[model samples]
Target: MSKKQEQVLCIDRKTLPASWVTQRTVLSMDFPTFAATCTKAKCSFVRRGIAEEDRQKKQIIPYILLQTADGGMTAAYNRQGNEKRLHDLWSIGIGGHINPEDSAIGTDSFESILKKGMQRELDEELARRVAGDPIEFIGIISEDITPVGSVHMGAVFLIRTQDPEGYLPGDELRSFTWHATQKLSQLNLELWSELSLELINSLNPTL
Candidate 1:
């Protein structure tokens, strides 16, 4: 059988410019409106390999940060078998690229497409672990200094779970564990996760 073509969303950074994106790494509260405005400009889907070559294109990354009922957060270590760039880095959020398949669900609204894509990713990555929990839009993330960061921007979500203890490490992760937000300093966090922790603390001072 032929290899399945992987398609992902791509938008020219120039065509859909966001001043905040290039200026900083994370924009916790102001990101949603900015991201929505950019997505409405010019966004399309192309093969993942092709998209990777286009530095001018910004690929969307929907990240879900799991907030456990016990007031701790869960993180996963990317296994070597995962994408080389992400291997060994600890990720506090779970997410992936927004693909062409996501837009096919219902393209009438851009927000709908994004939400569907995130839900699809959640189902594929976390399975029934977060089945009925409410997910909320938290913010956006960007890191233009790195090669991968140059072509991607993150849309983050926050979801509270009653039993995050049931979530197991599988797929691209070597292991998954829950930790107090205060203990993040002792862990090796991915760049995005580090920014996420900052945002979480800013919003929830008690954490």
Candidate 2:
């Protein structure tokens, strides 16, 4: 099948918790409560094209923010050379759409599925291993105002990785640099990164 015809994991917006506003980038939420409700909510694997246009369904993306123990973060896939709308903008997270391969849909709970997808994305993009114990859930991000954020939902996570050699990004993650978390505000960050910077600084350990 073509890329657009490929199926992706998605859940109905109504199935989300009351805290999930339709058009806001929410930085705080009860992760347990949200996870419990979502685990039981019915999800459908819809075609990518259709899912992108359906405001009723949310394509779940595990947006991972990688931070080192020394107080730095591995930034995004550089879009400077691309002809896309995000051109010249830097991304602060890595991860992608959850697929049927990551989750068995109705058979597996949302929490389990999300975990698998997060690991799969990390493994696929990085040359090193990302520890699972200290993963921090930042919050949910949504923006119905933008075309890309309109039909999608982001579950932001801050992962503590101890790569002594620093970040060497490739593939989907592309190229990245370990920037001091305190200096992130100086760079041109993507929308999600910009919106969540405050919370990240407050929650994640900084140098």
Query: Candidate 1 local accuracy as lDDT?
Result: 0.72
What candidate 2 gets wrong by more than 4 Å, as runs, is: 70-74, 80-83, 104-106, 130-133, 164-167, 202-207
Whole-model lDDT values for every prediction: 0.72, 0.72
lDDT per residue, candidate 1, 21-107, as tens digits? 684566666546855776667678767787776787878888888877655665555535435776777787787887766767545
- Report the Cα RMSD per candidate: 2.7, 2.9
Model 2 error, position 170 (Å): 1.9
Residue 87, model 2: Cα distance from true site in angstroms: 3.5
Candidate 2 lDDT over residue span 100-164, tens digit each: 88765558777888889888987877776545437777777877777777787888887666763
The TM-score between candidate 2 and the true structure equals 0.84
